[model samples]
Target: MVTPELNGGDVGVGVGGGSFDFQRYLSARADAVNDALDRAMPRGFPERLCESMRYSVLAGGKRVRPVLALAACELVGGDAAAATPVACAVEMIHTMSLIHDDMPCMDDDALRRGRPSNHVAFGEFTALLAGDALHALAFEHVARGCGDHGVPADRTLRAVAELGSASGTGGVAAGQVADKESEGLPVSLAMLEYIHVHKTARLLEAAAVSGAIVGGGADAEVERVRRYARCVGLLFQVVDDVLDMTSTSEQLGKTAGKDVEADKATYPKLLGVDKAREYAADLLAMAEAELDGFDAERAAPLRHLARFIAYRQH
Candidate 1:
């Protein structure tokens, strides 16, 4: 498949022959997801913990994971309302990971979302608990919200399991461990791929696949969405690596060149910038091909999403 080039034109129009406005779609869905997230956790007792939780959760960034979940749900003919809980749950898990990942024991980064890292603002212990609280609350929200939204119990159970696996030892945690161990060590392409696939792609895959499962997608349909998400997930990391190499600190919000600075493994380090770009193009083509099995109009958002990730400047 010939993937569309990023020529400063609106690539969203390339999906399904120009019927969708991806910017508009992203803004609207992001607003809805933000509102739901705000309501999901409130200022309550233990003021500091709640405040820390709210701080990270409300911090603005691209709501990419949640958007993917909702879009996948819609593509499977599920009501967006029914998928709201899963969407919020994915964001909560993501936020929790960010909080922990930024702590003194981990990346030790002082900035997140262009603001103070959670541990820096709230102290290390409080940040730790806040992450734990959000992680627990994610499961709780899915359990209660799905039922409240009238999604079937079996589907809710499956969603809960998916979230668990993505957040736990089998997924993000595994990737993080491997990443830490690999630092300063000569990393082969396979090891780097393992780290990226587990740390980044697994949660994304779960997000998209869980949405399909919750939205009543057939087994085969769910598998296809999983494939699409896997391709997009790897593409996301590759783009991030490229941006790290090319963008400046002012442009990236966080410190750019951190990967090279830390001697960490990245696609650009292994494959060269041009080859990394070629790999990203290939991944985007594969992702788009997976969407071809679905209805074109319903699949437009996801199709455009692949291109957006590929071409986004920051």
Candidate 2:
């Protein structure tokens, strides 16, 4: 396994000093991931099911989760390509969550990625089944991807476990349920955090950790990356809450003020926009601190990513 000292040498943050082209880097990685997703998606007996799954999977968000997986792999000195399976798997799980979350029973969102939600584009039942299929496909992709790419069985198993927990009760499901229960109810700061951490942070943690594992990172390296991703995950949601109030549908690509309409407890709702912004800044700083030990160049992508999430208009 790779160790910390061996991860990389002293380096500068790639953003301001080293001239890392973040947009180019993101585009390249996202293109690779999108292509892989297309290739991996099943096109079989149920044509509509396949279409529905593809609809959301290809809907085009930031692809932050999968990109984080790939970046974490490289940060630990592993081949970025070697972690593609885990990266793709994480995206699939994320996509499935988006699909299910947009259904009538859950968040009941109609717009996603600036387009009609899966349930809106397709029938509700088909959208539900497509989500279930994507969830199952995510695991299968990892197992098969490992075999196809020559990753060790132990590493593959560990990645699988990380993903399972991230998508299961301990992660997204738990968070979603708590969020639903807390809707229109007074939510404590601690309770709001619990909701986001489980619902949002855990999957991001799993993504980075799984990528590190598949890329053969030492345990310590994996855990450190997990911490960093957890901060980013919470930052993502906080930014979302702020944006919901500030941006419009034209900018956000989804129903703006949806949180307000739902009477949900959001950072801006409880903490006020300024305080929420301050909290996001604090989270960004903490996230960057977690990368201090790594080669600065290697950690630049993640650093910029934190900033990107914090300052993004959309």
Candidate 3:
């Protein structure tokens, strides 16, 4: 496990000094993730199910998770190209979570990324199957792509282990369960933290650590990346809360105000919109501090990314 001290270094402030173009990095990495998905997916499946998965997975988002993975790899002196597979894997897993989260049995979201959600577009059964398929495909893609790149078997295995651990009971799944239970119930701040940390932060941490592991980061740097991910992960949730109350469904491309409607516990609900925004900023600063030892240039995308998360309307 990554230590808390490593996670809590100097807080990052100001725009990153790195030359990395956030737009270019996001676009290029998203394209690579798409290409990897195309290459890794089966050529023939139930065509309809395939289409359903494609529809949602290919939907536009910032692809922030994959970008983080790639950046962490590069900062560790690892080849970005070699990390592409894992980056794609992170996206696949993220997509899978979205599919499941949108289920009627889950969040019951009707839209995603500015379009009808997978369950709404495709049937609930198909959406469920697609989510399952994507979950399996994530591991398959990572293992095959990493093997093709000659990543050591042990490291590749470690990446898989990390992904599973973060997405399972100790991580994302637990958060989901907590989220479901917390609705309509008065939840304490600690409970809210538990949900966000496990549900959102775990996978974000996994994405960063997976990239570092596959890219061959030293243990120390891997720990630092994990810390960075945690700060950003919590910030991501806080901004999400702020956006839900402030952004339109059209702007967010998802069901907005669902948290309030469902009486789900959210930072904004607890702290109000302005305070939630302030909290997000604080988390971003901490994340930046975690990356201070690296050249400012190397961590620019991450710094801007945190800011983007804090202020994003959608």
Candidate 4:
């Protein structure tokens, strides 16, 4: 596999004294991730099922989770190639979640990434099966890819465990269940935090921490990465809530203000939009602080990533 360039030099001066070019970093890693994903899943005997899985998995998005994995690996002096499997695994899990999240039993949305949702494009049963397939494939790919790439078996096992935990009741599933149960009901800020922390933050935390583990980070270093990821994960949702309230449907590429429409609990609803924005800023600060002990240059990508999540409009 071709190694991705992790250097910031190609993008010229970065923000705040030319340390890193976040946009370039994001673009490069995203391209690499897309390529890896395309190569990872191929058409199989059950053409329709494979196609359905590929359709949603290949659908465009920011590729943030995979990039986080790669960046975390790079930060710990690991080769980007070593983290590719985990990166792809995270995207697969994310795609699976999206497929399920848009199903009739869930959010029941028809649009995703500016296109028809998985269930709309494919039949509901097929879409559901597709998600299940991808979920299983994520772990399979991680195990096989890590072993093939010569990552230590122990590290690979740890990564697998992290991904599994993040996908199951302790993570996305738990959050989704709570979110569905809480819809159109009076929900407190604590409950809202619980839902987002589990639904959104846990997987991201897994991505970052798994990368560090696979990258051979020390225990203390892994903990720091986890804290940073947790903050950024929350920051991601807070910013999403703010954008849902402030941005246009066109700019967002999906329904805007739908949280309010659905009577769902969001940071903006609980804290007020201004306060939600303030909370996002706080999360960003806390996330960046976690990186202060690392090499400044190596930590630049993560720092900018936190800012990106905090300030992104969509």
**Winning model by lDDT:** 1
Off by over 4 Å in 1: 1-9
**Model 3 Cα lDDT, one tens digit per residue, 1-314:** 11112222222343464345565666777788677767666656689888887887778687778878887888787888777888888888889889999899999988888888899999999999998998888898888888777688888899999998887897888999999999899999999999999999889889889988988988998999999999988988887887788778887788788889999999989987777767877887899799898777776766666655555556
What are the runs in model 4 whose C-alpha is more than 4 Å off?
A: 1-17
Give the Å error, residue 1, model 2.
37
Q: Which stretches of candidate 3 lie above 4 Å from their native place?
A: 1-19
User: Which portions of model 2 miss their true places by more than 4 Å?
Assistant: 1-17
**Least accurate 10 contiguous residues by lDDT in model 3:** 1-10
Q: Model 4 lDDT vs. the true structure?
A: 0.88
TM-score of each predicted structure versus truth: 0.97, 0.94, 0.92, 0.94
- Residue 243 in candidate 3, Cα distance off native in Å: 0.3
Q: Give the alpha carbon lDDT tens digit for every residue of 29-135 in model 4.
A: 99999999999996887898999999998987999899999999999988888999999999999999999999988998888888888899999999999999999
Clashing pairs in 2: none
Give each model's whole-structure lDDT. 0.89, 0.86, 0.81, 0.88
Clashing pairs in 1: none
- Please state every model's RMSD to the true fold in angstroms: 1.8, 5.8, 5.2, 5.1
